[model samples]
Target: MKNILKTVIGIIIIVGIVAIFGLKNKESQDKKDISPNTSSSPSTLTVINNQIQVKNFEGSDFENITEKSIQVNQGSLVKTSSTGRGILESDNETTTIIDKNSEIRVAQSEQNKTKIELESGNLWSRVKKVFGQGEYYQIETNNAVATVRGTNFGTFFSDKQTIFMVSEGDVLAISINPETKKQIGPESTIGAGQKVIIKDGQDPIIEPLTESDKKLEWYVFNQTKTTPTATPRPSPTVSINPTPTEKPSPSPTSSPEPTPTPPEIISVIPKTINVTQGPVNFFVNGQKLKRVTGLFLNDILIKFFTIDEQTIGGTATSELQTGTYDVSVTLFTGEKLTLPEALVINNE
Candidate 1:
């Protein structure tokens, strides 16, 4: 009888332990379900003009907000009214403004980078700093990606084309042809007051500032006109004596203004470096890589044949492997900058 009782006690203890563990496991899961994970990084979004509507995947809707900063989510569409302007400040403190009649989708928002996919209309972005390596905010239009590091630029997408204009800083524009699927070389470096247009089924066109299109005068005028109005002053009365009138006729002659000096033109000479290859692999320097990637070396890709007429400098998978390769550096102003000769790659 005692042996049977001992067996029953052991079975009861096991059952109680299993039940306790099951309840604890269910409790932990319930906690997780009740609390969704959210990033603790500090970010803000402000509705600058009209009220903005917010919709979430949990079927939550918020409306009638004049100016409020709240956490935004991916795939959330922030739409503005006719006079509405919304500003989104990312976790990295990047600020972007959505102008009136515009719609922007928060594609990816993270601690490192914040990407906004524009469906239509205009957006002005000012990125303060890049968080880390490989951290960049990508603004995708219908056709291209405007990768920004720390820039102040505006994007306008209409009729399947995107117009990117830099107001203060620079941006790298990358576009892939719709039919050809080949990456289009960005032939232009968009500076402040410069614009680049990317149209579908056509090459990108960059134009300089025209006399009629320049807004520098307007900007200066507006800046100078914002001061407080000056009070009107009464005109000074002049009482002239008969004796002083005689002396005034012999007033001293005023000295002529000094001749204005013309500014000197400084000629810039680009430095050249040479590279030679043996039978090993080598990598370009960081600064050189940045310069090449910035479209300075795009001509090499097009004019690869002048060096090697045969085989087209190797296949797509296997680029030109053997022989000495010379890389020519050039400035944005069409000045030839030289690079040192070094062995790039050797397949043999």
Candidate 2:
């Protein structure tokens, strides 16, 4: 009886040990699944010039970000001085530029999605293509949310309104209900060379981008970084002739001719059409396009053309071949701008 009792107690202790081990393992796994992503590298904020401030979620005092770059996590608030500018590169393949006198919060950041809240300021975001099904990049203000997959865009948020401008690709703009914190009303699509403004109690207003808008100081600064400037070749030196050969009279100094600004066509209405569709009116919108004297699909000219400062349109006849082609515009000065794969022709 004593031997049997000892065996029974030993078995009971073994069973109890196994049960405790299983329970502890399950609890650890549950904590791992529920906790935020702590293993991924944190996003960073880099100062371009001047100074910036960072306020941690647990800290009340704002600390100056003087290093070349500093890691930023969720709940961090970034603010720029009146002349300060900074760049934020997240692990999710998105980069954002914080403009001067602006503030933003890193709401939720992870390897797949990054959400930023623009409290009061201007920001430029460059997002890479997100291939995953649930992956997204978003910028939010109090009244609006701008979501994109892969594109370059700018957002300006103020008390009065929020402006979304797309330099490339597209952005979906949606208004938010203040009290319930849910999306409301119809969504607006803002395309390249276009902007949408969202005001309180009003629908989104879409408009073509203007030259002045493109010339904003921060916009131009970003452009210069992406667009490379050609290096000027050294002027050829002319060796003086031995003994002053007949010195010709100096020709009158004439002013150098001004360089022509290249006109562009960014958006084309009726981007797709079937061959069966007779003639269709197509509108082209862009900057510095007022001087465009001719518009072409492939090599053929559009008929009944009308040109304006920011827009041009004409009838696209059905005689054109059914294939994708470039849309190009020629300025009066002979400079040309071409948008590749802009018009698609289809067969019914």
Candidate 3:
């Protein structure tokens, strides 16, 4: 009886040990599954001009980036200076242009999905066609979302409103309330040469692209890009001879696309700053300053005042660090003027 009892006790102890080892191995495998892994090459960010800043992820401080290309992972935040521009290229061959004074984040990036969150400013995206069952490319704002399969489009977000202008292909624009995080209206299908605006607490407004809209710098900039197919021209009409008594009908005439007018910066007063001083008022002398809506010293926005049609004043905050920075102004119509390396700030 004692021998039998010893065998049973030994068997129980062996089973317990086996169970403990199994649990530990399973836990180890789980940890391996959850650990971070580099699935693919990160997207590339190339600084086009001026200066930009990037933060790799949440809780990280922004680092200045200039005149170079760098790999950026998902969850990265990119902020451009007043006159800065950058280009982002994804593995799938989609390209996005980040305009000056813009902020964007790579919210999600995967083999078949890409999502960019635009906090403010402008973005021009040329997305590759997604033919897979679940593939998609999207840009989101506080009050709207623009989704495209393959298209060339531009987005502008300001003052709690989002505007989407499609140049080629189509875009799906959806309006949503930022507070409740719910759809405010039905989905809008924006076709080529059309624009849609989504405002807070309002339904999405759809309209065709206007001639003035085409005259904007953003529109003119994209005109140089190559399209998949040449736009078909309208067939010419045959003119019929009018009778002697009838007045000849006026012939229809087509107008050429207007070129965008670039802003001119003549000078910026108080070009040198003393950091020891609490704050200082600086003035910018230039053309077309009356429409100026915002002024930036590098990437920081300061208090702006329009003294006249050709002069703009800005008050620099004491928090400004010692550095040489660009001075730029933005018009209410989204036009911008940047004077690169225009201001020098010193600690002395």
Candidate 4:
């Protein structure tokens, strides 16, 4: 009886040791807390494939992408091949998932705001709660801009339409025409259970998301990817033509797509920051400063001022030193333009 009791005690000790090690392993696999992760760095690609290229602010080929974030900077573009899929997270409590054959452009990824342009493809965004006054996590396509105050949403953009759905929280979606450069339709405040479709030259369509739509592959936090077993491809048979006066042509050839023009910046208000303290408004005066997604002063990022609901330029990080700072603006179309020592300060 003594020998039997000794063996049982030994087994219990061994099992406890194994269990402790197993728990440690599980903790290692979990992602970090949102509070710290948001202030760390620009996104690192957790999963990636062979056909990824990182392009520079000038749209030049910056580097052939691996699972590395070294060559990626502001206004950098990530282009994926047909079989490519990748996920990236920023220090601002946001995760972006890009799926096969997509293009995602990092417009402005600062500590304050992160703006990504999903030019063409499938993107899943999971954003944490908004912290500051003027902070934003914006995902943009050609025809719509979806601002995620705090939510999980998926956007699928093809040549025909841009589809948006929110699985959690709220998303404010606005519709705009890429060709005509005009805001169309009423703004859509999408709740957790809603889905909306935005196409060019028309208002967005709102409806409740179906159960099958929930089965579509979207990235979930810390969960293993569920295999997408036969999600039916969304057909583009829905008509976009809202005009009834136009007669249909007998030919089946489709009209050519509109070539998008880049947004321009003409001037800057108070082109320098000289005050030692207080709010410094660095407003840019120009044609499409509303489409300006990023502002960098001497390569240091600052937040856009939203006071008085201004759509022009925003605020700077600090009061000015005695040196001239270079001004660079990144438009929503993934184009970056530099004005060359545009900001100057004089302390006499």
lDDT of 4 by residue, 1-348 (tens): 999999999999999999999987675543121122334345565433345667765553556664323435565688877755566677776777677789988777778588888889888787765757888998888888888788878898998688888887898888888976477877889998789899887788888899878767442221122222343444445445578787664444454544444355445545555544433445453444556667777777776532111124445534545688777777778888776777775543
Error of 1 at 226 (Å): 15
Cα lDDT tens digits for candidate 3, 1-348: 999999999999999999999999997784453232465347788765446899875334999874357888777889998866677878876778788799998877677577889999999898756646787888999999998988889999999999999998999989988987688879999999999989898999999999999988766554432323344455557576666776665565554444444456666755776646555555576765778888998889887765445456576656888889899988888877899998887765
| Candidate 1 displacement at residue 5 in angstroms | 71
Each candidate: how many clashes? Answer: 14, 0, 0, 2
lDDT per residue as tens, model 1, 309-344: 000111111334444444443434454543433323
Best first by lDDT, ranked: 3, 2, 4, 1
- Each candidate: what lDDT? 0.54, 0.75, 0.77, 0.66
Q: Which stretches in model 2 have alpha-carbon errors above 4 Å?
A: 1-41, 224-348
Ten contiguous residues with the weakest lDDT in model 1: 306-315
Q: Between candidates 2 and 3, name the one with more favorable lDDT.
A: 3
Regions more than 4 Å wrong, model 1: 1-43, 58-67, 177-188, 210-348
Query: What pairs collide in candidate 3?
Result: none
Candidate 3 matches the true fold with a TM-score of: 0.55
TM-score for each model: 0.47, 0.54, 0.55, 0.50
Predicted model with the maximum TM-score: 3
Query: Which stretches of candidate 4 lie above 4 Å from their native place?
Result: 1-42, 68-71, 218-348
